[model samples]
Target: MEASITFGDDALAARAAEAARELAAAGVPEALAAGDPTLWGPAAESQAADRLGWLDLPTTSRSLLPRLAELAERAREQEVEHVVLAGMGGSSLAAEVICASADVPLTVLDTTDPAQVRRVLADRPERTLVVLASKSGTTVETDAHRRLYERAFRDAGIDPATRILVVTDPGSPLEQTGIESGYTVVQADPRVGGRYSALSAFGLVPSALAGADVARLLDEAAEVRPLLALPEGNPGLELGAALGAAALAGRDKLVLDASLSATTGLPDWIEQLVAESTGKQGRGILPVAGGEPTGVPDEIVAGIATDGAVRADGPLGAQFLVWEYATAIAGRMLGVDPFDQPNVAEAKDGTARILAEAGEGPLPTGAPVLVDGPVEAYGDLPADVKDLSGALTWLLSAIPERGYLAVTAFLDREAAFEVPVPPDASFEVLTDIWAAHDAATLQGLLAVRTDRPVTFGWGPRYLHSTGQYHKGGPQDGVFLQITGDVPDDLPVPGRPYTLGRLQLAQALGDLDALRGRGRPAVRLHLTDREAGVRHLLAAAREV
Candidate 1:
């Protein structure tokens, strides 16, 4: 049950100690252990307090492990070979990490990318079990995925009931639908929030289905639980204190350097948890997960070490608890409600509003001037380099001292190219095609040219992951959004808009949200996905 998490330096250690004292004075640990809502600030007495059950999950998991194991056994008995988890953010990230280390095959479908959806449906549909997970039972992305997969299953002559499973809170619409549709439904603890449900059914169910040792995972978490109950030298509290103190002192970038052998997607999970929980009210801690350390004065490095020889299940469980507790404590230190995502709703509501007015007018457009085939110009500059160099110059110039550039691409990775390949092509080939259009080369060029850290995030997906940090975290991000026309758009079964339209709306919504926050941002629309990517690379070389 031993875990390793060290402070970056003596200054950080001293700041952590001071933060721990401040939290102790605020009675954060005691209030959390006692299930007192006061630790969440003035709104604790509302429904927010009722969702604090995750605070005690490590201690309560002993009762849930047996059921999770039984469910796993049942899936095996039914010959379920692949489990496709359809969820977003907290509901799927933990399962993804577990699947990375587990024996059972699992594919997490968190993106609404038409190509990704088609890939999942084409992979052993008859033998695959789709687990629709959502705390609220109404996450738009989750529901959309459910509809698409259900149609895919029906089209493939597979009974949706036999291939689908439901994981949600009791009495949720999804739960009722599962019952009416004759699908297996497993209700998660109603008291746990999505982000905090990593130790609850939302996480454990998928881990169990993936053949991970859920019992041992809970045992590891239990070990960390005791440490969290104490104020002094408590790993969770100390880590939280360090993060909070550093952020308040203007070192807001939490640069996490996780062991390559650690559980996959671990950094992504932490990014969402920290950013969504503490980034709000114009003050926030920005977690730079799995990115190259910028070494700027505003960065704090957090190293997550794992024994390279062992499976990461146990270590991952402990790490999950550590971050959950630390984030709760950090919220107290930052004086923000840790449970609510005020700005997250802004994008969601905006999307819904756009969807409601689907037929009213053309979807909101932040049109970039088309400079050439699939290449567009975003900012005013010399005509010779308007397509790529001009855009790069504008984006690079937007970066403040010590700030980073986030390249958010809304392009579908699988469909961004014009060249055709065989139907039986391997994923590696697809990846190679994607790489040709990806921002890796561009990121390197920016890093070398500007001497600033660069982060690449896929749109809609990043909206669910690091989008919080972009809007809610420190105002030090310069956003460059890349989007293009889909070769063929897929329509939502019953909705007026297509997935392509939804993607566009989301990208635009997020862009508007960032601009509303006054974070420097610009959008580039690629008319020819392949040619535009090459143009961008050419522009990077010039820079």
Candidate 2:
């Protein structure tokens, strides 16, 4: 498929056309391509100056091809065929999409769940090459992952320098760490923001190392790069105008359906790009990914298969470029800075404070108001609401018109848990937790009760992604968070807290951040994940 976009129905198309016309008159595309930072006004000019490097990444990122090829060849020569990616948010999402769309195998470790970490460690670490990616070079999750992989390689009697590849900005702490430890470090373009780094080293390096066609990806992106600077008939501008116009018209819920695209996980990457980039300043677009939405007035489906108002059909690389361009334009229209994620650090700070306050035990949280079977419901459950179904219904009731429900899961996302099923449970939840099916199930369950869109995000991982939007964007969102008891908790190497503790802190931290922002949110802890999943599933079905 070629890289391009199609405007939606009559009203949306007209609105988009008018918005695009306004943008053309204002010289949005030209200014963006010329790296003029003043397009975003005074509030964002400084960041805009530094963050527009992505505009040229389609060509500039090609410089890394040789080094990436060398890394791939080394991995082959060393008999290290397995690729494990340890990154969060933008650091990993782009690579994750690239490898997935290319049908290559790259194990993504974007979580702090002990079971998840344990599963990664159990993989063939001896022959696994771990790509440690962190834009800030100081992310706790990436550092913990680096420590574990280092220890794992050491325990397996392998030199970590041969197995560790570091990706970060130059002069960052991770680059220094990689250099001090004799590991190869690929520094991404410092001027590129994390979410917009799809065509840069951060996205290209890991995918190249994992045997994806990095060159072809770059070629595809380059094929569509020129259109981004065009005034009219530009796919990026058209799509962005449609998005901004819709949001401005109170149809801010963006339901993305990339089923028609050649890329498998484009919607997810776009979700982060748009949500993080636009969802701020007390107003932003909310991306409802991977569902069949009815296309309510507050919702616009950006489907690839002609199923929506904004049809974004493109090859993987081109899709990334277009989405980045469109999200930037949308950010300009929405009156927010697309480059900086202002509220992302709120959850991290909360996690730190929680970890510091909790000492060695479970993160301190107020007791669950209701415990039904294996499920423990935290958050505001009305005194009269006794069952899990009732709690879910109450949360659903909190979702306002033009608002959305965000279902976040903090559990080990396994394909299948081998735990014994509880006899009293209504049914078995066999497959959702691993793929975050439980959260999705609850999302759909709650979705049917209201016309509003519902979104599902994996925990701590989302903290680096949509957590910014949840805290900083519109105040109409209602949240349902799922976290469970980690019986076999694993500790971070040389750290006081376990991965389980870190995961819990992240969950509670985000929960508090949402609550502190006056957003209605709740946490449901599964006492016995298997039984809890079963109960949660059954209760959601009832809700």
| The candidate that achieves the highest TM-score relative to the unseen native structure | 2
- lDDT string for model 2 (119-212, tens) is 8898887779999999889999999999998888899999999889899999999999999999988888999999998888888888988889
Off by over 4 Å in 2: 415-438
Candidate 2: C-alpha RMSD to true structure equals: 3.0
Q: lDDT per residue, candidate 1, 418-482, as tens digits?
A: 45666887999977766666655566667667756577777676777677767776677898888
Q: Worst ten-residue run, lDDT, model 1?
A: 305-314
Clashing residue pairs for model 2: 8-309, 413-434, 414-434, 432-437
Clashing pairs in 1: 374-527, 374-528
